[model samples]
Target chain A: MTDDLPPLLLGRLNHVGIACPSIDDTIAMYARLFGATVSTPPFDLPAQGVRVAFIDVANSQLELIEPLGPDSPIHGFLKKNPAGGQHHVCFEVADIIAARDAMRARGATVLGSGEPRIGAHGVPIIFVHPRDTGGVLIELMATPDHY
Target chain B: MTDDLPPLLLGRLNHVGIACPSIDDTIAMYARLFGATVSTPPFDLPAQGVRVAFIDVANSQLELIEPLGPDSPIHGFLKKNPAGGQHHVCFEVADIIAARDAMRARGATVLGSGEPRIGAHGVPIIFVHPRDTGGVLIELMATPDHY
Candidate 1:
């Protein structure tokens, strides 16, 4: 809040996650309309509870995630947004645990076990509860160097 | 869709538009949690039917839109998501008219008057109907060069 204090994280938007019931159809739509292509096909991350594919853009990427099982994390989101929509937004952080601590200290709620988990990128990440964020899920991933 | 065909646009994600009932509260939350400092501050755009502010990140930006008048374009969205949410994703296109024609040729509906209009960044932009983009609102703006 002060002009003298620098931001806690780099604040780089790594990706925007989209909850897709069908990743293949989403891929086709993006390509046919925007010429946006996806190279790395969808891969299942059972631990993460979804199948994800990345669509590269000039700076950030669009992450397409499809429910993998009945207990998929995005199941509720899809139930509400049946046509699929932006699910969450990911940002790069300097220190996963420290950022987590700082946020918690400020009365922010970190989703899950309140600890870092290996994200689909194999980087440590944590989700900030949307209730504290005006109903938008926020993911903070450790910088690649930290990983 | 093919390796040979490059995207029609720069594929740069211009910004993710967020419909906010109160931009002030959203700005405060971002700064408190992510330390996302928005230096330029919020300003009104009567013609666009909303007040706007840009939060800069590492690569892309997040746009906060606060409806201005009774018929503000975002009134319907706020009624659905009072806490606010990501409304649309924008990408940079090399040729607005060409891209519009291309998508129309493919049967994707372009919203508005089907012509480029000046966006908040003072760039020419148009919205692609959500029905065509898997229920996600997509905005295609003329790349800086074309603008």
Candidate 2:
């Protein structure tokens, strides 16, 4: 049966990124609340100028991201408003290529073009800028299972 | 087969509430992108002094909320910041009654107790003030299905 549904653009939520003042504190809180354990400790994303850590949930994850240096984008965001809060929502897409094209046709801007890049859990991913998508930074990924 | 996984503390995502200067503009943009029409137009929430509308997705929604009066919370939020962006994420719980009790025991404050009210889809819901949830307003609901 060809489901004829608009093709479930997002497979499942890969992760949710939350901006944190300190990963130490956030990790501790998540551990207590959801029994999440630190899977990926703070690592720098030089390209994005931010550091991130992942607290593994059963299938999804909680990513805690902090700015690496003063010039980082996350730092600039923190400068304006320093309250530790949600940064973005990441979804696992069935096909990054098709999903990116579909979103672009719908007037959404794909941050990077070409082959999908690896993210948490070695999943191939792409990012959709907030400017084109109602002010929410959305990440699309293809999980390892699909790959 | 019984999957012993602890059921999601919250059901599927309820909505992503955005505090925009104009709900009409936000609603138009979302409609264009998601290919989903607004389930309802602006309705004033006098208790909060704001107007809200929702764009339904597969199992969740995107909410566009704007301040109705100048003294409203959203009005102040927009004035205080330039990049008035994604405001909050809401999740549906299994039982608002039990969830509220558990959250309170965990040191979280429940905003509107005893008002087990219906939301955009007539599902019972409640809100936990951001003040209690690390400065982010969180909504909890008891929807029928788990997303």
Please give the DockQ score of every candidate, comma-separated.
0.64, 0.19
Q: Write the per-residue lDDT of candidate 2 for residues B8-119, one digit (tens) a residue.
A: 3654566767778778777666555544466777898766667888765544566778887767767767775434567776776667888777667666677765476766
Query: Best-fitting candidate, measured by DockQ?
Result: 1
User: In model 1, which regions exceed 4 Å deviation?
Assistant: A1-6, A145-147, B1-6, B145-147
RMSD values for the candidates in order, in angstroms, are 2.3, 5.8
- Worst window of 10 by summed lDDT in candidate 1 chain A: A2-11
- Per-prediction fnat: 0.68, 0.15
Residues B51-143, model 1: lDDT tens digits:
999988878889999999998989999898899988999998878888888878879899878988888888788888888888889888887
lDDT of 2 at B32: 59
Off by over 4 Å in 2: A1-14, A31-49, A53-61, A69-72, A92-94, A98-109, A112-116, A143-147, B1-11, B34-36, B39-48, B69-72, B81-84, B112-118, B121-124, B144-147
In order of appearance, the predictions have TM-scores of 0.94, 0.71
